[model samples]
Target chain A: MKRVTLFVGHYGSGKSNLAVNYALMLRSCGKPAALADMDIVNPYFRSADSARELEDAGVRVIALPFANTNVDLPALPSAIYGLVESRSEYAVLDVGGDDRGALALGRFVPYILEENDYEVLYVVNFYRPLTGNANDALEVMREIETAAGIRCTGIVNDSNLGGETAPSDIEATVPLARELAALSGLPLVFTAYDARLPRPDVPGPFPLTLQRRPV
Target chain B: MGNKVLMKGNEAIAEAAIRSGCRHYLGYPITPQTELAAYMAKRMPKIGGVFLQAESEIAAINMVYGVAATGRRVMTSSSSPGISLKQEGISYIAGSDLPCLIVNVQRGGPGLGGIQPSQSDYFQATKGGGHGDYHLIVVAPSSVQEMAQLTGLAFDLAEKYRMPAMLLADGTVGQMMEPVELPDEKDVEFTEKDWAVTGTKMQRPHHIVNSLYLVPDELERKNFERFERYRRIQETEARYESFLMDDAEICVVAFGIAARVSKNAVLAARAEGLKVGMIRPITLWPFPSQALKEAADRVKGFVSVELSMGQMIEDIKLAISCRKPVELVNRAGGMIMSPDEVLAGIRKMNGGDNQ
Candidate 1:
């Protein structure tokens, strides 16, 4: 596993959910884990929303300075530098949505590329409106890469309809995920699904618990 | 749920607007409603439509007015403060009888309040926010699916009535993701507007689109004609949903996110043997008044749940002619009411206030 991991892709594509889960999983496995939230495009449903839970479980949460504030200023916290510079063994950075969102991640591109031990997983869901097919999904993935100035290492198929997702729904997206992986030349790293549902047949099943929203 | 796609409420409205044959979109960035413009920016140019990120909310709305005059479907969206800026344009559009969709994904505010979900704009939306006499056919969507479906309906109703229409949403619904089956693109058809100010090309008399009348009697007659259209809309277009109301004695009226929260309270109250039901108004302007009026006879009392200081309660009172006491269950300043608070409000209706 890479020391520095990033989750980026289309909006509403479950990037924050996967980032939070990956950090928690690393913490649960007794590794020194730190989570950084770099999203500025959305005001709600942020990984920072679960800062308390992440902090309580021994995972260092470098949350947004303006987490619960009303203002929509694109204020990036200085603490975000810890995502690349922190002494934690595993650092998971949750980038914002799409190309506009990936622009925030570009600042760390040189440092991350120099480190050369990082992984940028392009997390995608075929069920999201903008990226329903492999061709459309590839275009978005390329847009994110260009905007972020980094190439994707792998693909995570986090495809399912929220609350209405069944095992069949998870299974239905496998072919689309494979097609995206083939087109983008990125390996199929894993397929994420709701942990409550029984794990369906997919390569590298990464069961996920939904993110806790801010109270 | 056929071939369902997951989408945020803001994005859903954008896609559904495009599918509804709206080719011109003008909006400025504002939280909770920013994604709507972002989606339009990405999709509009690819489809040969006009998508402008105007310098100001006022500018965007006036551009919407320009597009509407040419008899093409047009829209502009903003949050609370931005919506306030567009009020004058909305009134102008209504006065001119030009059809357009103006969306307000509301946040807390008297002036630049928090970017959290709020229904505080109820009074501004239902009553006239702009000057003079007019109503923008307003609709409130509780879920992302309705956000998509109602966007299409809003454009249809605006064209049919030849006035401005609004989708009154809040931050919660505007930001939440839900599975939705969008309308097929092939079905979107735009009808001809004989009243449009399209250039004559030396063919016939020019059709003028204007709200200004130099004479008082002429302006008065225009106002009367607009009111007649409003009267017909009020009679024929009031839509709402009734939940667990057939056997309930205590009626709860809410809309948008508050209504979604109230539904859970209604379910929990029903489980505890409390005869509580909910009336969710789909149309806030043509406010499903007859439903509440009908429910008033059977229901013992009413509870109006909201994210504002009881704005919708005013409509509830008028809808039922104040025959029953309408208590308020609300939280203001960007706070959301939980199911427990709403259940407590329901309990008060049951007996807490009796003795």
Candidate 2:
């Protein structure tokens, strides 16, 4: 596993949910994990919404004050710097949605790039209307990469139709994900799906607990 | 071909509005409806549609009036306080007998309130937000898919009736994600606009579009004519979903995000051996009152589940004509009622232990 894992993608591409599950997965595997919510654009459902869950599992959570609030306080705390600098901790940064959101990750690029131990995972959803196809997904990915000032090392297919998601839905996105991987010249890392359901019949599937705040 | 894609509720509404041939989108940004405007800002320019970020909500609604006068599909969206800013323009649109769509993804408010979800704008939508002797066709959607579907429906109804239509939603439905199949552009059929102010080329009489009638008699005639159309709508357009209501003893009335929560609550209450069911109103203006009136005959009582402080409760009571007792289950100022809370309301209405 890479020392630093950053998830970046189009909005509603399931980045935050996967990021929360990833941190929990890392901690369960007896690894020191930390998650930093960099989503300043979205008003709700950031990785920080699952802060209490991550903390309960012995994973460190870093987010701006009023992270889950309706207030659009786009301030990032200095605690996020500690996440990247710590050599012993496995850092997972949930970069906000789309190019607009990726702009927030700009200032941290130099530190992340120079370390040479980071893997920026460009999360793509084939079921999202705007970035549904491979070409559109690549264009969004390029824009996000430009805005964040970093290159994506791998592609994570995190496609699903929200609550109505079926295993077939995840399977149907395989070709699109592969095409995205081919066009972007990045390796297809994993396909994410709800872990509570039966495992999807796909290779390198990453099952997630589907992180959401208890309503 | 149906392509069901995952979409946030706000984005779904925007996409469906475009698919419904809405060519002009003018709006000022306000959460949690900001994504709807942002989606239009990105997609409209690419599709040969106009997406203008007006100076303010007032400016946006006036721009909507401009496009609407030209007999083209136009819309503007905002949250609660922002909607309040557009009321003057909305009243003007209604007074002029123009067709357009106004979307309110409601947030809690008497004022700025908060950005979180609230259905406090129910009275503002159905009763009197725009000060006038008129009604704007109001529809509320429970799911993300419904958000898209109802956007198309609202535009069609607005044009058909030559009136303004409001898609009254809340932050929960507007910001949440779900699998949705957006309406196809080819499938949307807009009504002809013979009353529009299109250029006559001096060969025919020019069409004049104005809301002003200095003569009281003329204004009163317009008001009477508009109410006649509203009567037809109230008779024919009231839409609602009856969930497990056939054998229900307790009918729960709700809409938008509240209906979704109430659905789960009704299901849970049923599982607990309570004869509770749900009536989710889709059209808030021509509210499914007659259906509730009919339900009142069979059901012993009614429960109104809402995110507001009992705004819709009054509507339910009036609908059933006080035929049966009606109780309220609500939370205000960005708070939402849980399925458990709604189930408790159902049980309490049932007099506990499955009365």
Using lDDT as the measure, which candidate wins? 1
Worst 10 residues of 2 chain A by lDDT: A64-73
Off by over 4 Å in 2: A69-72, A213-215, B187-192, B353-355
Each predicted model: what fraction of the native A–B Cα contacts (within 8 Å) does it retain? 0.77, 0.80
lDDT of 2 by residue, A34-109 (tens): 9999988887678888889899999998987876566557998898877777667999999999899999998887
lDDT of 2 by residue, B264-318 (tens): 9999988988888889999999989999999999999999998988898898989
Give the local distance difference test score of model 2: 0.89
Model 1, docking class: medium
lDDT by residue for model 1 over B1-355, one digit each (tens)?
1479999899999999998898999999998899999999989999988999999999999999999998899999999999999999999998899999999999998798888889999989989899998898999999999999899999989989999999999999999988999887845455557888878889878899898999999999999998998999999999999999999899999999999899999999999899999999999989999999999999999999999988889889998999998889999989998899999999998887522
Tell me the deviation in Å of residue A197 in model 2: 3.5
lDDT of 1 at B83: 95
lDDT of each: 0.90, 0.89
